[model samples]
Target: MEVVRIGIIGLGNMGSAHAKYLIENKVKGAVLAAVCDARTERLEWAAREFGNGVARFAGIEEMYASGTIDGVIICTPHYGHPAEAVAAFKHGLHVLTEKPAGVYTKQVREMNEAAAAAGKVFGIMYNQRTQPLYKKLRDLIRQGELGEIRRINWIITLWYRSQSYYDSGGWRATWAGEGGGVLINQSPHQLDLWQWVTGMMPKRLRAFCAFGKHRDIEVENEVTAYAEYENGATGVFITSACETPGTNRLEVVGDLGRMVIENDKLTFYRLRQSETEFNRTYKGGFGEPEVWKIDIPVEGQRGQHHLITQDWVNGILHGTPLIAPGEEGLKGLTLSNAMLLSAWTDEWAELPLDEDRFYGLLRQKIEASGAAKTTEEKTLDTTGSY
Candidate 1:
């Protein structure tokens, strides 16, 4: 296939975005061939916007069988990610799904299995991974420039949503919709990066999640989670959706140095000697390792979604490595699920989370959701995204 004709399932905010860029010929070696959405209004919008050159289908299977697309980007709701991915793989099509693979890991495991069995290109929209800042941090840790990691803390709460956002119709934060709130929609990338950039996942964690803490939604809008890694490294993650003048900062402490990311700048506090080595040999009680502060250059994150799409297309055409493999998405999703599980049970959640238990509890939340929507709908943020 010289050119890949891509179909986007789910004409919601993110899917329509893919449609616009693909139709604009922004992605090399890829074209917008088809779009699928269960909503008639979205399908009509596609027809009116792209004309008949691009096919429109209400059913994904119909679009897949039409033979117009070589692959699909799943922009469906969180729960639909896995099922659609598995279907796409069964039909011998590459799959690139949006974040948080699924509401729970058990279903995502099935999707990952399908991708492995099909041997197709499976990517996820963890566009943040493309950011130069995160790349540099990962490289520094992996290269041992920071020595052994001892602690990590991230405070990313800048995603401010007006009450009208939840008031918007068909809200995804509801138990019946996304099965959770901020973590599901606004924070998946950070959750992914929490373990990804550090090359470490917490062995266990205890989380305190406040449902409707700042909003009227039923799921968590604020979260404070503490984690413990296997190597005795500790971590803290705090996120919120309604805080004003929010902050985005990350700190990683290592034996040789400390790295801080704030205000789009990376600063490293390098120790002249490893704290471990210094403590092992230093006889002076008041002495400490010398510290040097250096500011590292970093580029802003631009065209993240476009970059990820282009990477996926290139992967299909040239067998290139994917920036965010669909399987690795499970790791981030696991952390989010574990947080929710821990909060629901009022206890610590262990790694390799209990998928069945989380699944069952999520079902209970869905069954228990009885809130009535009383506000009109508003569109998702096209620039910053939902």
Candidate 2:
């Protein structure tokens, strides 16, 4: 019954995808009022595709002054997230920002502070968590069905990108533009899922990354990280964009059983711990460990981005809880930044990540790398393992 007007900032790949979702779904309680992008082509494309009546702006000032929208979807590149979000908040508009809210923790903190000062609903587009498989995992962990988690291993190498993919955009591989390659762009979803399901923070992390594997890039394309949790649980994070054939397998080993999600399928091996308790009394039939194979029926909406947009709209209009708040966005960015810092410094980095230290390191890398901060208006390759 209520209409939530949305203004989309940045018409890049994900921005375009969100725009399409908004148009196609005719999502309840939400309407795309305006679109903003400095690129004339993108503004024209949105006008042509959506309609000429749709207000198009080449600058944030124009969009904010247009008085045609209620909220903003920040779908810009990495570095622009914080500033765009702050501007949106300043305009008295709610915000739903694209993931990895910021490439560095300091920027995320700044964005959070700005949002807090504005008192608007600021959400993050962590659409992967809306998947049935991960939601089920989070529920199981919360229910204590997984008992005490001892270890976790997430091998998220399915995000394989070629040199041609990186070449499609000038900001693709630079520190000043995209910050870091795989960790910043590809692995944020997985990192968020990891921390979400585990409900614990890593005390320390060490990583070894491949910075020279790709043909034309200064940032890393491959990473292998070791994380030690505060609860003494250990986790392994492995990712790469250069592997020829890659796979994504996440296994969480707990005291009661082990939950494994691979290739969109979830399977849980239920360990019969009660039998061991009985064996303690009888002291017999303890020769072998007992377990039962159970395949979890994964229930999830097929279209993630669309569902995320719908939820954000509902949250703004009807007070629905956000699937991922902007604050949680910092954890993934922190982990990604820490991983690179560990690899670059050849030492383990700690969590509740050192904001000043990470930002200092990131600033140094951006200064040392001779690259542009933002990409010019052009067609971007959107077929990035979506």
Which candidate has the top score in lDDT?
Answer: 1
For residues 1-386, write the lDDT of model 2, one tens digit per residue.
37888888888888888888788755788888888887788888998899965688888767876789988888877777787788778889889988879788888898999988998888998988888988998899889887888899999888878788887777678887788888988889999988998887799999999984856788988999999987788999999888868989999988778999997888989877833353565555547447888999976585377777778888787887888888789888888988988987899998767778877887888877757543311222211111
Local distance difference test values of all predictions, in order = 0.86, 0.81
Score residue 118 of candidate 1 by CA lDDT: 99
TM-score of each: 0.94, 0.92
Clashes of 1: 1
Among the numbered candidates, top TM-score falls to 1
Could you tell me the lDDT of residue 292 within candidate 2?
Answer: 87
In model 2, what lDDT does residue 142 have? 89
Off by over 4 Å in 1: 299-303, 371-386
